[model samples]
Target: MLVNSYGLNGMGIEAIKLFDKMPRELIFEETYVCVLNACSHSGLVDHARSIFFNIINKTEKIYTTMVDCLSRAFLFEEAQILINNFELHHSPSPTMLMSLLSGARNKKDNHLSEKIYIRIEEKFPKHKNRLVSASILLSNAHASVGDIEKSLNIKNKLYQLGLKKKIGLSFTEINGQIFKFRAHDRSHPRSKDIYAENDKISNELIEHGHQFDSAWITRLLDEDETIASVLSGHSERLAIAWNFVANPNTKQIQITKNLRICGDCHQVTKLIAAIRQCEIIVRDANRIHHFYTNGQCSCQDYF
Candidate 1:
């Protein structure tokens, strides 16, 4: 738990220190995985590699974690090689391929995305659930690069197959009470104030020279929707807006998201932390991000 907490807070070095201090007899497979995850989240790829190679008994989970570390660093060739070597002795794991695909999506590498999707299809044809996730990642990779037609095609195929995507949601706690929000949610009693706060923050962001990037938009904007409008409605943004409405003088905001935070929301959160001179910690599906007051994230832009 300590190692995971350190990783969650982007304190990889501290996590490593604890791992080293642990008694030799006490170290287990999970211990290695935790440390590798810490290194992955904190961008300590070299450290992760060293630790990974030294392990005497490498498990599928360990290889997946190492693959994730390399993938997050955009070392596609190295990651692929690791996956290939793993498959030599063991069957392929969907989790491993998904890690590489996710990294390709983050980099918007269309070619790599297609290649990885093909591999996934060839290996996991019968695995409907994993295929759904792979398709989503592949579609997102295309959408991120303005290939909306391809993205829509993937989505349409999923719909035709009757496979549903998971909905994104964010949760926050204030005054000992937890609140949940979805994209464009208006169910909260203080919905008006929350949106107004978001608008105010959006204007401040613009003043700070933050332009909403349309590349992050995955679909066509409605007549009433601008890039800013759609982005401001993201679940995490709504959660942040609620934080401000619930407490105007808040100095710290923490949120938990059910999905990976999108690129736009990640950028906006960094700017918001700087603009408000507050600390913002978001625990997304992949990892935790600590947004500091200087417009920097704990992940160091790796995410």
Candidate 2:
């Protein structure tokens, strides 16, 4: 709880300091998980690598965590080397591949993603979930960097395989009620108001010189001119919009996401926090990001 809380606040150094002081016998696998995570968010590459290589008889999960730490720090080559050296006791792990691919995605390195996929294919050729999911990842990475043709072809192949990309979801709670949302969602009873308020927020952001980029959006929807419309419908935005609609008295708003928070949304959240004079906390798959009303985020934009 302590390490996670520090990480959640984007205080990686504090988390690291606390974890490092514990005796070796008292430190368990889970402790390293948190420590590595803290290091990743803090961009402590040297510290993370040290922890990675120093762990005794590291388990696969620990190896994966260290990979994530390196990936988050943009140490792609080192991360791949670590993965390659691991003596696998079973079939290749899809999550590790996905993590590496995410690192590639950050750098928009399509070739690297393809190479990683080829490696996965060689080892686990028949793993349905692994292949399809990785194909989708490769598609997104290419598309994000404006290689629409490659992305579309991968999507078409996914269609041939009858695998659909899982819809990303984000959730929030208000007035003791839980709300679920998706992209372009209109099923909510107050969707009309929600969408309207979302537009209002978007207009505000644009007026402040906020420029949306394709890197933070899905390559699928980002190719079109309707990018603004698409961005307005992001689940996290909708959740925050709902809070504005009904919970104006709240000083801080916290949201939880099932997937990684896109860069576009992250930027928008920062602008929103400043404009509205409120603090927001977002817990996405990668790490927790805190948006302060002063146009600052806890993750320091590293995540």
Candidate 3:
């Protein structure tokens, strides 16, 4: 009715009003979830907090939803407080805890990260999955602070648990064309063309005072250069290659990946963005990492 009577733009506010008009008994778990979602959509922190508190007497699911909303809003401290105060424990859902850790990492609050790690271990002793998840979080935090050895050790522990890091892949649509690639994938029909273009662009970058660091390049290249050639086959690279072939004059490419991007790929993407003078938006497992020509990334090399 709101959409038909007013417009789609007014539907949300009208829906909230209608929800307000409904008796308290009519509001349930789903209602609380919807309200929290609305708060997320509209950036209504105060309204979200009020509705979140109201649902506290309801269910753990509601608490989880509230925690998710607060975390999405980057209110990690508040989210932590909610979890701490309510003492809500629904095992196996490491999202809230992960969010808290990520928030601390973003803030460079290493002390808090250590404390949270201990708290998580103590509070959820039965959930062994937290070990891997927490380790990954700690690895990320360590990497952000240039503690490479510590980060690699954490990653190694996960690998020891038989949990290998999945390669990141992404596909982008440009001018009605879809391009795709996986890490070290060489199966694409246009593989040769992609390599040729990468070579050309890399040369131009070097000529323009962009020094390719041995550390970054060494990771991509193998003993036979075969492995290095495979790096171009990465999903992001594949998408970029496709974008290059599909669009003749486009300036930007957007790719979304399902996993946390590896260190090597992150470095390469930044260089690619700089050399091409194109905006590359990469949405990874954690957050969006936007690469640009000024040798910078949106995550500030934090992820």
For model 2, how does the per-residue alpha-carbon lDDT over 1-303 read when each residue is reduced to its tens digit? 254445555677888889889989899889998888877776677888888788887888888888887877678898888787774454456677778987887788888988988887787778887788678768768877788888888878888878876677888888788899997788999998898888898999999898776655545654654778777778899989988887766678889998778778998999999998989999998899999887878876756
Q: What is the lDDT of candidate 3?
A: 0.66
**Candidate 1 residue-wise lDDT, 1-303, digit = tens:** 254345455678888999999998899989998899888877788899999999988999999989989998999999999999999999999999999998998889978999999999999999998899888888878887888899889889998999977789999999999999999999999999999999999999999888897656667778999989998999999999999999998999999999889888998999999999989999998899999987878876656
By lDDT, the best candidate is: 1
Query: Could you tell me the TM-score of candidate 2?
Result: 0.75
Would you list the clashing residue pairs of candidate 3?
181-235, 182-235
Candidate 2 off by > 4 Å = 1-10, 88-91, 125-127, 166-182, 186-192, 206-211, 216-224, 246-263, 270-303
Kindly indicate the candidate among 2 and 3 with the higher TM-score: 2
**Which digits, one per residue and each the tens of the lDDT, describe model 3 over residues 186-210?**
6778777776766665566456565
Error of 3 at 278 (Å): 15
Q: Which ten-residue region of model 2 has the weakest summed lDDT?
A: 1-10
- Each prediction's Cα RMSD? 5.1, 5.0, 9.2
Could you give me the TM-score of model 1 versus the true structure?
A: 0.76
Give the worst 10-residue stretch by lDDT in candidate 1.
1-10
